[model samples]
Target: MTRLTLPSLAALLTLAACDAPADGPVQDPEPAERLATGPLTPAGPAQTVTADADVNLQHAAAVVELDEIQGQGTLTAKLFGTAGGDPAMNGLYVHAAFFLSPAEGWRVFRIGDVLDYRVLSTGPGRVELEIDESVMDPETSEIGSRTRRMILGWAPGAEGAPPETVTVTPAQ
Candidate 1:
């Protein structure tokens, strides 16, 4: 049997609250305003997640239901990431999987090398993520530490299709 500690129970409650559907569409108050700051702690201790992709888990995994975002249905979104690849290709990699209700498995998406990410908005069938990434110097073809915004949207259908991703870079 699994033992539920106070902290784990609290986390479960918080996850439940987040998964709950709102009365209507949810929106971000501001473009830069963050919806949630940190990832929700899973019941168990953080461990390395082995996947088909060659990457190490960077942070604690989070669970969010797509129904809370898109209002489509009860599809669970497992969000996690990796520290990165080699030193030359060091960058945070974000991964998200959608578990379709009544289905036995899930569809995973390896969201490229996002240096950092923020939850911009969620609900109404769409989860917008504002990712801060390092931009390379096009002129010199050298990767620099300069950071910019790369927005990603995950609005998959209940059929478990690929997520709708959009990367937008604001004018500097």
Candidate 2:
């Protein structure tokens, strides 16, 4: 047996430890590329509406009704914007009144008006409204608006009804 010095023993141990296992070639991994630091390129083409597409305005109105009115009211045509050449006639306009209750009195409501009890949504031959109530916060004494949905329909034969004879009912 040969006697080994401390330096030689340490060197041999280092060499043995550094030996790679007999699996495959050892190579350093490629460095990760740095991220670009400027305005980002769009991932895809810009979205656009097709001119030939049959855009259904009725469905859009129904979505707006669900989101806004959620309630309903009967509207009679006291008067409406005349068709043709009138920019205001782009949408339906009607001068109608809402009868909430005998005590509350008959109140006139126009399109887009936020009244004490209701908000009116008017369209060509369509009238809808949402009942609104003011709620008072006990803690901060702040008032907030609360809406209730009413389903509007025509009654079979009710007196003092509109020419269309619509009735308001709480939504199921």
Candidate 3:
């Protein structure tokens, strides 16, 4: 038979003290105060507007705005074949990236890519997209599903003039 040492006996006593009587009633503490009631009221009055107020508002808005590309965009490059053919692939699929203007760099995209804005469909000379600008949930990383349509098209022009004139419009 093993004899309990002083330290071991003290540890056992400590553990026994920690455990509540099994037959005792379990009392749950009262529910916490409902901290979240409804939309919170602003803490103070709105800031005074000044001549530069519009500029300040624009600067704040720009932080969340999507980078807009010019209308003269094109499906300038494509990636095909197996997954290895493109660095942006998720699996075996490959997709095309575009250039809004020849002077602008490429905007890379892959099939079924969902972003703040997404490419809904793509074809030879046109690309359709949906953009959402609603508030997002910080906890779950979810955003409202409301969206607006955007269509991009390439129009061919005569010689000596620009070969392509890109147009961006909302889908009817």
lDDT of each: 0.56, 0.44, 0.49
lDDT of 3 by residue, 6-124 (tens): 99999999999888577778766444533445545799889886566566566344332233333433334432212232222222332334544567654544433222456576665
* TM-score, prediction 3: 0.27
| Predicted structure with the largest TM-score when compared to the true one | 1
Decide which is better by lDDT, 1 or 2: 1
Whichever of 2 and 3 has more TM-score, that candidate is 3
Q: Write the per-residue lDDT of candidate 1 for residues 1-172, one digit (tens) a residue.
A: 9999999999999999997888898775563445345445689888887664534322333321122234435555655666644445436766666664455465656766756666666654445666666667889988766444444455565475544452333423
Better of 1 and 2 by TM-score: 1
Where does candidate 3 stray beyond 4 Å?
A: 1-115, 134-146, 156-163
Candidate 2 lDDT: 0.44
Task: Score every model by TM-score.
Answer: 0.44, 0.23, 0.27
lDDT of 2 by residue, 1-172 (tens): 9999999999999899888477878765444422334446899999987655556654333221222222334423332221222232222232344454567543443332221233355443344555544556899987666676654444322543433344455652
Model 2, which residues run further than 4 Å from truth?
A: 1-128, 131-133, 137-141, 156-166
Best by lDDT: 1
Clashes of 3: 1
User: Of the pair 1 and 3, which is ahead by TM-score?
Assistant: 1
- lDDT of candidate model 1 versus the reference: 0.56
